[model samples]
Structures are given as C-alpha cells and as structure tokens.
Target: MRNVAVVAFPGVQSLDVSGPLDVFAEANRFLLPDEHYRLEVVGLEHGPLRCSNGMTNFADRHFSEVQDGYDLLLVAGGPGLVHQEFADEIYAWRT
Candidate 1:
C-alpha cells in the first residue's frame, strides 16, 4: 500500500486536509488491496488539532514520531498557518 501523510496543525483549513484525502479514500475502494493508500494525519504534536471551523481532528502520528518517508505528503493550510511558527524538525520531516 502507498503511504500518504497529511500534515495538520492548529487552525488549519479542514478542507485542505480532508478534501484530497476523501478523494484518495474513495479511489482506494476500486483499487487492489496492495495499491490502496494508507492515509495518516500527522500533527506537530500527537493528539487533537482544532481547525479553523472548530472541527477537531486526531493526529495519527506526530512530527517527531514520523520516521518513514511517505509516497505523498500533504501540508494542510489555513489563514493562520502563515503567521505561525514551526520547529526545524517539522520542516526537516517534510524535506
């Protein structure tokens, strides 16, 4: 299976993370088991992330915990994202 990680943080736009993931999930149903995507929501810290719309999303993994490189990495964005600061480790994981 292909590993897909969606990076999320506080005040993230919910759609930015969920929209594309939903599409991939739906497509998985039509693919073979080995070709399916294994989706994971990664966060700065492990726990809950509050979105711009007040929705809570649980992090399947945290930046510090992620070791394996994913087939796809999606960075979720929001109005507040640009104004926030992240640790060097988080950026390193992305690269």
Candidate 2:
C-alpha cells in the first residue's frame, strides 16, 4: 500500500488539502480497494491546527514523528504559504 502524508499547518486553505484528499480517496475506493494509499493528516506540531477561517483540525501525528516510508508528501497552501517557517518545513520534505 502507498503511504501518503498530507501536511497541515495553521492558516492552511481547506481546498488545498481537501481537494487532493478527495481525489485520492475516490481513486483508492475504486482502483485499489484491497491495497491502496494510507492517508495521514499531519501537523507541524502535536496539536490542533487552526485554519484561515478559524476552524480547528486535530492532527493524527506531528511532522517530526511521521514514519519515513511515505510514497507522497502533500503540502497544503494558503495565507500561511508565505511564511518562511512553513516554506522551510515543506522544502525540507518535498521531493
């Protein structure tokens, strides 16, 4: 199974994260039901991630703690995208 990690941070745009997640989920549902991508919503730190609109999302794991075998890493963008801290973090793992 493919391990996919979706990176979530404060002020991240919902669509940026949800769009690919929806597509991946649907594709996995039809194309690889028996063995498919394992999706993980990860945060930079271990806590709730507040969106640009103020909605909070609890993450499954911290970015530092994520296992090393992921097949894909998705970085969500929004107002937070301009932050240098987030950029550094994303660049560190983007391949």
TM-score of each: 0.91, 0.80
User: Which regions in candidate 1 have their CA more than 4 angstroms from the true location?
Assistant: none
How good is model 2 by TM-score? 0.80
Task: Give the C-alpha lDDT of model 1.
Answer: 0.88
Q: Give one digit per residue, the lDDT tens place, for model 1 in 11-92.
A: 9999999998999999999999999999989888668999999999888977788778889888889999878998787766
lDDT score, candidate 1, position 47: 82
The positional error of residue 77 in candidate 2, measured at the CA in angstroms, is 0.3
Q: What is the lDDT of residue 11 in candidate 2?
A: 85
Q: Where is the poorest 10-residue window by lDDT in model 2?
A: 86-95
| Candidate 2 residue runs with Cα over 4 Å from true position | 84-95
**Considering every candidate listed, which one attains the maximal TM-score?**
1
